[model samples]
Target: MLVLPKESRKLFKGPFGILHRDISTVLPELAGRTVYTVGDVVTHTLQKNGITPSIAVVDGQTMRSPCSRMPEFSGECIRVENPAGTITDDLVKALTYAINHTPVTIVVNGEEDLAVIPLVIAAPEAAVVLYGQPHKGIVLRTIDAGAKAAAQELLGLFVRVGA
Candidate 1:
């Protein structure tokens, strides 16, 4: 089970927690002490509310799109390596999978500036948000709009963990 604090969403890589049903052992702390996703929590919540969410994996897509390609920067003008395509088929595959699975919320951690678009279009009701870094682990950028508050909370949690 994964119990991720709402604030820690950014630092998390995949689902709040990836549990092996057979082994039944939790991994060591990945980041701060907080547990973002826990099966027990999810189970209780589901028993109380009757909800199950699928997991959506968010990957990156180049800014350029079909029929256009980002050139290998050797000189002044940027060139298109492949005019046939801009976005990769794998990205489409992942997105399509997400649509089919229909998880409760799609957590996006892609590098694109505005990843919320496709995710929103694909899963309109899903919670599309980004993650931030842990203060002690990385300096983290101020411009990361999604992770700011989470980072601050992570920092506080870190101090608590240290104490």
Candidate 2:
């Protein structure tokens, strides 16, 4: 497990890829690529646009508030518990499993915000990982060797918790 330090949290503010106000604008780029959504709003927007992600992670909340309704996904739903500021081993394992099985929805019991780190690190090359950028828009990161290395570097910044 890893916990993000308060001082280092700002490093995660920037987007990992291109930003789009609407998911429709990004749909054309996602064709023939594995898509992983790290937030509920991003997953909902993609689903509303008729694009089912290869793996969708949602915590049933948006911006720390309870979502009006859960996003609907047509694939198998795997539930995992990840707190607000920390990533657990369960999350890493679930993400790995989801990467192996396409069209899986990871229903997080806590927050899903930081799941993008593992998603980017473990996703196959050329896979697209999408997440909401708060009030801005959706950030789309296409997985590559550079992206994987960058995500791994960021993960290294997180303080390991427990044994």
Residues 1-163, candidate 1: write the lDDT tens digits. 1123446445534321122332122222222221111122222222233333242222222322221221111112111121111222333344446556543222223232222222333432313222211121111121233343443443333211111
User: After TM-score superposition, what is the CA distance of residue 87 in candidate 2 from its true location, in Å?
Assistant: 1.0
What tens-digit string does per-residue lDDT give for candidate 2 at 68-124? Answer: 756796588899999988898999999999888878999999999999999898899
Superposed by TM-score, candidate 1 places the C-alpha of residue 52 at a distance from the truth, in angstroms, of 9.9
For residue 137, give model 2's deviation from the true position in Å.
0.5
Clashing pairs in 2: none
What lDDT would each prediction earn against the true structure? 0.27, 0.89
Off by over 4 Å in 2: none
**Model 1 misplaced stretches (Cα beyond 4 Å):** 1-53, 56-87, 102-115, 133-163
As for model 1, its CA RMSD to the true structure in angstroms is: 18.1
